[model samples]
Target chain A: MLDLHNLRLAENGVPHLDSITASFAPGTLTTILGRTGAGKTSLLRAIAGLAIPDAGEIRLDGADWRRLPPWKRPIAMVTQQFINYPHLPVLDNVAFPLVRRGEKWPAARDAARAMLDKVGLAAMVDRRPSQLSGGQQQRVAIARALVKKAPVLLLDEPFVNLDYKLREGLREELVEMLRTETGTTVLYASTEPREALQLGDRIMLMAEGRLLDAGDPRAIFERPATLEAAQVVNAPPINIVPLEIDTVARMGPFGTQELGALGRDLAPGRYRLGLRAGDIAPGGPHRARVILTEVSGSETVTHLDLAGLPLVMHEKSVVAHAPGSEIGISARLDRGFVFAANGALISQGASHG
Target chain B: MYRQKYLFLLPGLIALTAIILFPLIFTIRVSFSGWDVYNPGLSWAGVKNYVRLFEDTRYWSALSRLSLLAISTVLIQYVLGFALALMVWKDVHARRFFRVLFLVPMMTTPVIMSVIWRTIFHESLGPLNPLLDAIVLGGQPWLSSPGWAFAAVMIVEIWQWTPFMFLLLLAGLLSLPSEPYLAAKIDGAGPVRTFFSVTFPGLAAISVGALLIRLIEASKILDTVYVLTSGGPGEATETASYYIYIRGLRDFQIGYSAALSITYLVIMIVALTIIAKLMVRFLVKGQS
Candidate 1:
């Protein structure tokens, strides 16, 4: 188990992470989901002992990791950019760490070869790093980290540079491999929701260097705690629209609807309504004009202008909606969430007629 | 496309052919003829000059000594410069200062360095002798003695050229991709293993190229030896270039000097070719 208590990190006199306290369970994958510059990499670096937090205590299996140096922390970190020695052969690069520990050449070679074979790179043992492709290089890095066999493994967007097929395959392979191979505490950071959903046993949603929510993958996806969390978990991002509470009753379309008292404490003014693209039904009380449609094979993402507000909808089948076509839309309230104008979650238990 | 590119490079081609190729052909032609300063005429001498060059023990000794100097200078410069480059590459304290300091010797004029060294190495009044006398049992002649003079000349050549090696090596180190070093570090490689397995192999190309350049430069070592030894102490430090200068200027043997110059040019070209071929092979293997 890796635990961070009241972790506050600052850079250049500006706060990066403000009092983040979290624990990663052993034998489980904990993924940090955030946008670019959301302090995800910084958090991973802090855990890896590459970056030290100003005021925080990092504990590994109840032992103080904050006091230990990086080499002594029993952790291995793989950065986004593939770091492989170009001059050395693939086998030697993977075996490098053991040599420093005074292992003989033959033993180091055997250990490196075993790890490379685990990563399906045995055939390329004699080849240099530059001779390999980008994906191959990433795999080599993974193999090197695995060879170290550190208790804590920190990966920073490991599959970001890979193609879709390679990314999915590696993700599944890595998830299964980590589950079966060892009980190392893995903390993987990524901006992709699919990756987070596929690999994360527990997902932490973050935005602007602050943790928005943390829970099981299902709960985070199905019932997000904040607007940021909802947006992060949704495939095409949750569609957010501003509505006047009093106007919902006065407007002819939604006609005197209570909305299950979702945004009750909104002072009878503005509130934000969030609904996943899958929850937005085609026929409903709300009407909008289709602004754009993007067809990506089996799914079609349609952008609508509803009441002069831009909204996005993801449809299972291809919907050839023209730019000026009028569309009727409604929300599945069970899958919808309401928030105050200040971006706080109001309620997610609203019922629909 | 080829014609257009050739037209663009027409002026350079014409100048090279006229100034370089034409003179080289004329020199080769003159080398085989029995021409002298008095006659100013050419008669086919066949291999007479070549035979004389082989029989002359002084010439053979001079050639052998120059070869020794070239090899020693190249070896010392390569070792010292490579070591310095590795030290700087490892992020030593005051790396910038050391880098700049290593380059100072290379930047100084060889003639001036030789003059300074000449005074320092003087047998009686020089500072070096007194320092040696105070430290050791006896003070030996540095430039006046045949053996010491040769050693002194080689040292000056090394001092002048080691900086060139350092600059090339440093550039190579700086341009290397950081991925390999990080990979080695992550693999738990100690400082020495990392250098041999990663750093040295990465630096192979630059090292070979630098050594080849140094070899060529060492072979032509003249200014320093001229300033310091003046090819004295029984021609102890007389390089091929200095020999040509002595024959042409001092002895007034224009034909003989020109003939010897041709032979030296041919030998240098052959030596450079072999070195270049080896360097190319090393570079290719390193990349692979």
Candidate 2:
């Protein structure tokens, strides 16, 4: 396991990463998910030694890995940009990492050709990066990184420059490669929540230079450690409502909220209710007037107003509702998270009832 | 619409023909005839001026010297300037100070630089001599000797223009895509391998660009040579441009000088064409 202990990086009197501590298991693919300027890239850079930590201990199997220089470390990285050396052929580009290791030219070329073959780009080995499409160039970059055979692989938004379909297809292929390629700890950084959910075996959600939450992809999203974590992990965003509990009843726009056993024991005070879009099914006891509807991919998300407070319901089916129509919206109460007034996840959104 | 477009081009075309075409035509006319500006007799002399130009060893020597100066100055300047650029481009302390300091030489007027260097290269009493004397190397007449005079002129040229190359190359270095460098480091590439594989290849265009500008400018340079050496010490430092200046303007051998200028122009065309070809090859090497 690669363990990062209290990793803090400051630049220009401002902290880029604040007390980031996490452990990445061997041969596991983890995605660092965050919004722009949320320190996802900074955390990746720190791990790759591009930005050294201000106060931290990076240990690789109990050894101080921070002592190794960037080049000396066992690492392979693919940047977010389309990067291929403009003066070298794709074969040479793929062979570059091996050549840097003092390998002979012809041997490096053969190894690179094999690596390219793995990326399904063997025929275009002689072609330059510019001669290929954006997808092809990114494949060449990946081939270059994979050829290094580093134990640690870091990808910083590598598919952000590509088209949506390309990103999706390449991501599937990359996850497969990481699984098949043994003993490599792969960390993919991206701001797109959908991408993180699609590709990450485990997801690390970072925000404001802090690693907010981490775990299995489903667990993190279903029960984020905090309200901010819930917001970053869910696509189309989660609906948050103010809660006022007094004895056995909870006051808020969510009238039919079932906050499990904790709901009865909670002090009669203010709190926040978190509901994932997928959990708010249509039809229960509470009624809401439809405000808008958005259909994307296989799911249709309907926006509704509950007593003037807006909420959204994500349904797997392509269901449509007209504006101003009153519909019964049910919260999968157990799938609804309860947060303290200060935004900490007091009760996880699960079958606690 | 076509007529309006043509009308809009009328003034510019007229200006181009009058200001540019007329002088070129007159020069070409004078080149073919042995019409010395000193003598009033003007008649066609066939290829006599051209043949005489080929026979003149002094013109050939000047051309050779100018070529030598161009090649050596460009080579030395590129290496020194690129090294300096590399030093200041990375995380160097006081990088801004060094950047401003390096730019001082290029910012100085050529004439001013020449005069200052001339004083510095003065035989026994100059600062250079005292510095060399302190290091057990003195008593060399810098501006009085043939070889040393050429060296002094080339030195002044390099000193004045190295900063220009440095500036252009620095911009190129800074604007390079950071992805490749990051990829290089992660790939276990040492400094030398990374430079050759990534940095140098990426810099190919700027290198050729700086070389082209410096080559053309240095080949036809005359001011520094004129000020420092005055084409003296047995005509050792007489560059092609200085030769043309003396023949066409001073000696009034207008026809011969005009013919010689054509040769210089042809050489420039051929040299620039070669450089451009290299640039195209470089740019197309790893591109679509």
Candidate 3:
């Protein structure tokens, strides 16, 4: 178990993280999702003991890590920039930590070779780091980290540079490897929602140095605590619209009427309604003009201008929607979310239509 | 396209031939002749000068001392420079100060530095002798003694050139990618293992280049030794160039001096060739 309590980090006198408290279970992949400069890397570095926090307690299996030096910590971090020693042969680089601990050269070499073989880089063991390609270098770095045999694995954007196929493949393999082989506590950070959703068992949503929410991946994505969380966890963004509640009118099924007394403030007043891109259906109640359409090979995303608001929807098959074409759009209310203008989620039985 | 480029190079080619090739041919011809200021004409001496060069004890001794001076200077400069570079590489605080301090010796004029060192090594009034006298050590004759004079010359050579090595190696160290060190650190490598397995090998090219430059510079050492010792005491610090100067200017043995100069050039060329071969081998092995 890894726990970070009241962790606060500041850079150049500016606060980057404010009292973040979280725990990551053993043998689980916990991904932190955030936009650029959201303190994701900073948080990871702080946890790994690379960057010191202003005020915090980092404990691994109940031992305080803040009191220990980085080398003494049982955490291994892989930064975005692959740090492979260019002078040493690939095998030696992987085996470096063991050799440092007074392991003989032959024993270190054998261990390094085994780790390199696991990463599918056995043949390049004798070559220098510079001789390998970018992907290969990243793999070597991973192998080196594994050779350290640290309990906590912190990866900061490890597969950001890789192509989609390689990224997916590595993600699957890495998750499985971490799960079966080491039972290492993995903290992976990425800005990509699909990657976070795919890799993370639990997702921590961050925005502007604040933890908005943390929960299981499915719950976090399906029911974000805040609009910011929703925006960060879904690609192409969740479509949001401001609407005034008419209490006298009939409420739709699974609509704002279910929100009882809380609908009083929203009565005949402005409220933000959110519908995920995936929740906006093709053949449903409303009709709108097809403002634009972008076709991706696997899925097609379309932008619809409805009620003077733009709503984005994703479809599994390609949709031929030309600009200015009128199209019917529908949404399953249960699958959607509604929030007050102040950005608070409208709880069921407390909001009006 | 080739014709136009060749036409542009024609004048440079002709000048190179006249300035470099022609003089080289003349020097080779003169090296074979028995010409002097008295004769003012050339006569074929053939292998006599070469044989004479081998037979001359003074010339052989000078050559041997030159070799020692070159080796010692190269070794000392490389070790001192590499040590300084490593310190500068690792230390964050006082790095700029140390860098500038190391370079001060290199920046000083060789003649001025030699005069300064000579004053410091003065047997009676020099600071070094007084310090040695106070430290329970006997003050030995520096420039006045044969052995001390040779050692003094070597010291001066090392002090002047070590900074050059430091600068080159420091640049190499700075240019190296930081990834390997980080990787080594991640692998739990201690400082010593990391240095030997990673840092030293990484700085190999720059080290070799610095050593080669020092070797060449050491072989041609003239100004400092000339100022400090003047081939002094009893020919103890006399180098090939110093001997050539003595024979050509002082003794008026111009033919023999020219012969000695030719021999010196050949020896230097052979030494440079061997160093170059070693450098190439190192590069090839590194690549493979």
Candidate 4:
């Protein structure tokens, strides 16, 4: 097991990690999910010993990791940029770590070849990294890292630089390869919610240098502990609208709202409502003016203005909602999350009953 | 008209022809004549100087001696300079001060430095002899004996030119990406292994370039030899440049010396080309 306690680091008066305390059990893969500048990379680097924390205690299998140098620790890392030794062929690059660890060259090469085959780069073993495409080069780096069979493996946004199609395919291939290394502790950092949910046995959500929530992927997605955690897990961004309930429930531009069984037990004063963009469908009671629309893959993400409040809608299929055009939309308010004015989650829309 | 653009290139063309092409053509023409003290004017002497040069044992010996000196000094400079560059590359206190101090020798005038070295090498009065005596090591002939004089000249040349190697290599070391070193470190490579696998391979191209440049400069080792040794002790330390100077200027056999100069230039070109090919084959291609 790898454990960290009170990990804190700051630069130029801005925090990169603040009192982050987390642990990973053996044989578990945790996806550190966060936005850019959210300290996901910082946390992984700290684990890999590339970045030393200002104040922290890192323990790995009852050993004091803080005293060990990066080389002394049994750790392997793949950076965001595809980093392979340009002077060596793919086979040699993969075998380098093994050779450095005193393994015979022939044995090291055999191990490297097997690892390369697993990553689907068997034919390109003789090629230099510069000769390969971006995806292939990344696979070489991945092969090199995995060949170490180190107890701890860190991949800091490894597939982020590749195109979307390549990223998806590589991620799946990586999952398959990782399945065989059952004892290795893996920390994969990413900025995408869908990737985290798809890959990680556990999800760690971070925002602005603080680890907001960490648990099972489904549990965190269904009931994020904070409003910030909810915003992080939703891709098109969950719409946050003000809700004031005194004698009755009131939200958005609509004058009144029907507080169904989901709101019956809530003693709401001034609260915030978390609405997933995918839940807001076309053709509903409320009318919204489309501000802009974007087509990504086969999905359409439209920005809208409901009365005066800004909202975003995500659709499964491509749809062009012209700017300044009025459209009728219905929100699944029953499934929305109600939070206190302080950004703490008060109740899940579905779980309140 | 488009012809005007060609006119704009005239000054540079004229400068190139005068400074480079004219000297070369003039030297080739002069090599064909017998222009010496006996025959002050250029008179056609077909293949006469060339035939004489082939049999001039002293001239051939000097050429061979020069080849030995140039190659040895440059090799020593490369090793010492690379050591010094690695020393101050990083993790040192006041690196900027040490870098400038290391470059001080290359910045000084080589002739003046050679003159100073000659004074220090003075058998009885020089400070170096007394320092050796103080250490219980007796002083011997420095500029008098042939072997000692040859050693003295090489010492001066290595000291003066090693800084050039240091500067080029330090620049190369600084520009290298830090990622490879990090990778090597994480691979559990110790210091020596990391150096052989990462730092050395990373600096291969720059090392070849610095070595070639230094080799070219070291071949023309006239100033130090001229000031310190003066081809002394029965021509024991005489190099090709000093020998050519003797034949061309001292003896006033301009035509024969010009022939020697042309032959030396051709030999240097062929030799350097072969060396460059070998280096690129081994250092760069073989490294990959």
TM-score of every candidate: 0.82, 0.87, 0.85, 0.91
**What is the C-alpha lDDT profile of model 2 across B1-288, one tens digit per residue?**
467888889999999999999988888888887878656455787778889989989998999999999989998999999999999999999999999899899988898789889899998667898888889976577898998998998899999999999999899999988777877788787688688777887888788888888988898899998888888777989999999999988988888898899887888799779877876686535332
Candidate 1: CAPRI quality band: acceptable
Model 3, runs deviating above 4 Å: A246-270, A281-297, A300-312, A317-334, A348-353, B1-9, B86-101, B125-140, B190-192, B276-288
| Per-residue accuracy of model 2 over A1-353 as CA lDDT, tens digit each | 89999999988987789999999999888999998888988887887788888899888888897867788887888888877776778998888778778898899999999989989998998887889999999999998988888888899899999887888899888887777778889999998888888888789999889888888887776668889998898877888887787755464766645577647557788888777787788878789999999987778999999998888888998888998899997876666677887788887644531
True contacts kept of each: 0.47, 0.72, 0.49, 0.58
Error of 1 at A76 (Å): 3.6
Model 2: fnat (fraction of native contacts):
0.72
Model 3 chain B scores worst on lDDT over the 10 consecutive residues at B279-288
* Per-residue lDDT over B135-250 for candidate 1, one digit per residue giving the tens place of the 0 to 100 score: 88567788878899988888888788888888899899898887665555445554676677777788887778788878887888789978999898888888888987887778
- Model 1, A66-99: lDDT tens digits are 8765555677667889888776688887777766
Docking class of 4: medium
- Candidate RMSDs in order: 4.6, 3.7, 4.5, 3.2
Segments in model 4 whose C-alpha atoms lie over 4 Å from true places: A285-289, A324-326, A351-353, B1-22, B25-29, B41-48, B91-94, B123-141, B145-148
lDDT of 3 at A292: 88
Better of 2 and 4 by DockQ: 4
| Per-residue lDDT of model 4, residues A1-353, tens digit only | 99989999898889999999999998999999999999988898788777888998889987988867777788998989888888889999999999988899899999999999998899999999999999999999899999999999998999999999999999999999899999999999998999998999999999989999999998889888999999998888999888888889999685578868657878858888899998789999899999999998999999999999999999999999999999999988888898887889877776421
Clashes of each: 4, 1, 12, 0
Determine which window of 10 residues in candidate 2 chain B has minimal summed lDDT. B279-288
Model 4 TM-score is 0.91
Candidate 3 lDDT by residue in tens digits, B67-158: 99889888988888989988898757989999999999999999999999999999998999889889989787998989899989989988
